[model samples]
Target: MTRSELIAQIKQKKSFLCVGLDTDLTKIPEHLLDEEDPIFTFNKAIIEATSDLCVAYKPNIAFYECYGLKGWESLQRTATILPKDCFSIADAKRGDIGNTSKMYAKAFFDPQVSGFDFDSITIAPYMGKDSVTPFFEFKDKWAIVLALTSNEGSADFQNIENAEGVQLFEQVLEKVNSWGSIENTMYVVGATRGEAFLKIREHAPDHFLLVPGVGAQGGSLSDVCQYGMNKDCGLLVNSTRNIIYASKGTDFAEQARIEAQKLQKEMQIELEKAGIC
Candidate 1:
């Protein structure tokens, strides 16, 4: 979706919640195993339950890639059914050589070639511009580069300071923002690093941020909004296991809805406070 469309959805839903489909076969409801495609079945139900409460859905590719062909089919089904107005992201975290990056872009953005269409793809910027630019070639698609991740290992590289006294992630923000605009580029700013949001905003005042690690990871919603929110409500806070795996029983979907509703309500209040709604 385009930038205006995404902002419109955030206003219409009074939310910026991004539901993560980090579906694990072993962790899903036992009863769903009887279905032809348990993962898709679970995802369909989850989408049906939380569609109105969220503005986006992100499916981590590894979850299905490990399952192979059957898993791919399930992802295909999930992608096909995703609500058009709700942004869809392939949380693949892919970036390679220039030519290869183009293929990756086609895989996620071109449904005819890859059997699924994603509004955006997560990218690792370790290889620099050529590795990341291919994804931006597509209209209305986005390249969400990794900035400050939620993982502990990120401290090893992302926090390393340069000779200029700027940290690696800060440099990344400046460089990546130069390649794309606020319209098609976004950064992955982990909610767990709430304190970093202020610094992040200084560099990316207008760009949208796709934040993870809120639910199940102990990140505070209030803390994230306080620092990360922009005039357009430029944040897509994602919750994975805490919502999708809310229960491993027949009541799973209902439980997921409850979790999503809780977040949406909190988001609505934040939007109101920021005068964004």
Candidate 2:
């Protein structure tokens, strides 16, 4: 999707919620195990139940890669059925040399080569520009670079102060923004880093942010919006276990919808408060 299209969806839905399809076979309803492709079956139901309430669906790649060939098949089927109105994210945190990065980008963005046609892909910035630039070559697709992650270990590298007294992540935000326009680039700013959003916005006021760690991770939604929200409501707050696994029974899809609705209502309120709705 183009930048304008994404902003339009946020306004139309009165939401910026991104539902994470970090589906685990063991965590899905037991009955689905008998299905030929249990992962895709579960994902289809969840997408059907909550597509109207969310603007994005991010399937963390590892969740599918772990199951080998069958896992990839499931990922393909799930991607094919994703709502056209919603953004599709291959949450594959890949980073490597130049040539290798091109293949990774093709895996998510080029449907002619890979079965999934994703709107964005998460990228680790450790390898610098070559690792990230390939994704930008794909028109209208996004490269969501990791900035301030929510994990405790993030402090080890991301928070380490540089010679200019700037944190490593801040430097990343500044440099990556130079490579592409806000239209094609975004940063992964974890919701757990509430006040950090303030720091991030100083560097990326117009760029969208793919925010995780909200619901199940105990990140405050109110705190995130207070500092991170831009005029376009440039934030996609993802909820994974909290919504998709709301119930492990046959009523799982219904429960997921309820959870998704709750987040959508909260997002609507935030959008109105920001005067974007």
Collision count for each candidate, in order: 0, 0
Model 2 TM-score (2 dp): 0.99
The numbered model that scores best in lDDT is 1
Please give the distance, in angstroms, between residue 161's alpha carbon in candidate 1 and its true position after superposition: 0.4
Q: 147-229 in candidate 2: lDDT tens per residue? A: 99988888999999978899999999999999989999999999986898999999999999999999788799999999999
The residue ranges of model 1 lying beyond 4 angstroms of the native Cα positions read: none
Instruction: State in Å the error of residue 190, model 1.
Output: 0.5
Candidate 1 clash pair list:
none
- The 10 consecutive residues of candidate 2 with the worst lDDT sum are 108-117
- How many clashes show up in model 1? 0
Tens digits of per-residue lDDT for model 1, 1-277: 9999999999999999999998998999999999999999999999999999999999999999999999899999999999998999999999999999999999999978887789999999999999998998999999999999998798999999989899999999999999999989999999996889999999999999999999788789999999999999989999999999999989999999999999999999999999998
